[model samples]
Target: MTRKKGPKIVVIGGGTGLPVILKELHQRNAEITAIVTVADDGGSSGIIRDYVNVVPPGDIRNVMVALSDIAPEFKDIFQYRFRSQDKFLAGHAIGNLIIAALSEMRGGIDPAIRELSEMLQVEGHVYPASAQPLVLHAKFTDGTLLAGEAEITAAHKDIKEVWVGNNPWSENKKPHAVPEALQAIEEADEIILGPGSLFTSILPNLMIEDIGRAVLKAKAEIVYICNIMTQKGETINFTDAEHVRTLNRHLGQNFVDTVLVNTEIVPESYMDFNRYDEVSKQVVHDFKGLREQGARVISDNFLLLRDGGAFHDGQKVVDELMNVCSNPIKKRD
Candidate 1:
């Protein structure tokens, strides 16, 4: 009998969710590739992108730390942020600054991430959705145009649609997924999206023309790990079906084959509103709606509560993903 190799998984998205899933997949010994969003324009990432003209490193740094097989202390040091009265560096994470510096030294973000990954002894590939920094542009149902991920989400208005492009202030330039990212998606055994901010974190990568096209064409079983809570500005009061609809709408087709939903309820009074203010309520369940969208639904008590917040159980998500890998879904012609 031959030993079967672990599955090749391509995880797309950014924000905190991607790292959580990546860490779990790494522990499962999956061949992982992370496609991080580059449309960030807030906090340490925003500042670094502004000054260095590189893709925001905050998301990439978090992903790197997650896949890194290095010492816990080293990961802490990489994630360290300054709290000095010095206005220049205050609130900037050490890893973000280092990544920015490396971007400059290496002449681009692609090379910089490669260098950092090796240094961190990363267990997988981390590719920015685009080589250059991107601006997220959203057209709200209110017919207002919002630029930048931070601004769009803050608008708190129902979004009609979104796209990735050159920074709004820069000369109009086309942005596409780097070849590595596209290749990863095309060759992947399973592609997972989300558990992250729908518009801001996950969609930015899919907004790239080639990346979206590749995903639609890929032979892999695409799985969307739906969020557990309704996001205030983005997906407020969004049902599980609405989540699938949003992704389908953005991709121009019903591409998702499976959706992993959390069936367990979050205690109404348990969440700390002050800490998780972005969460308005638990994501409403709509099994029939999800199935109607043509997704093979996998519902379970996949909830994990920590620090007064509800999150997907990483281990459970990976278990489902492994199942998807072994018993791949048939592609609709």
Candidate 2:
């Protein structure tokens, strides 16, 4: 039986949220291009970036593992974390190390990432939003300026504005877009933003000037997969409407054409996780306000906490996105 090729889809985001979407989308015959965020400043990525002076490869590693057409053992090996009193291997992922070594050998991030993708046999292409090591500078509501991803995330302060550093670390003379990423956006039949961290995972990609321009220029239907629960430090009290507003502020006024939100009520029994309680679990979709913003809402059972942590039901979300793409409507401008 021959499977029909699905739509060409470009997903832009980073972290765990993106891999979940990529894994589900790969199940379909869609041509997937993942534009990953590279602003990470924590964990193994931070260690490597500080020591080796390269783009943080953690998100790229996650996306590769998610899209690889390999055995579960392979994925586990890539994701394996070493636990030791040894300072070097303490909390690093094996995949991160592989990426770091490749980057070092290849002279930069672009070639290293390309080699890793080929080695993984990834079903989809993954590109960094920028080859540069970006410092996420934020102007807090209290008028204090915070620099570096770690400092901004830890400050726990309300961000008024954010921008990339004056001198970003890409090899390109200008902090340019990944040509492949931009091409994917231009040719995409649909573009999906994430159910990921609002400020960190999703918005960081948009901070790239060329990527932002490509998104605005793309003719494909733009969709946002709203997060099920608010992020603790980043999106503290953000409602679904507020989330859209924040993204729109970054991408522009009439950016997203549709929003996929979770309307499924989570079972109380599934809410016993300490992490859920810490983040104040609750659905935050604002259907009325979403419509008011000229974006229609597609509500569904997106919440699934299998191992006692909140997560999107990847297959369910993918199914809904496919349905929406098949039945396109003229977006309200």
lDDT of each: 0.89, 0.81
Model 1 local distance difference test score: 0.89
* List of clashing residue pairs for candidate 2: 132-170
- TM-score per candidate, in order? 0.96, 0.92
Candidate 2 segments whose C-alpha is farther than 4 A from its true place: 1-5, 166-174, 267-269, 272-278, 330-333
lDDT of 2: 0.81
What is the lDDT for 134 in model 1? 94
Residue-by-residue lDDT tens digits, candidate 2, 109-199? 8898878877777787888887777767788888998777777877777776676652344455546668889998998889999978778
Off by over 4 Å in 1: 1-5, 84-86, 168-172, 331-333
Candidate 2, residue 302: how far the Cα is off, in Å: 1.1
User: Alpha carbon lDDT of residue 155, candidate 1?
Assistant: 79
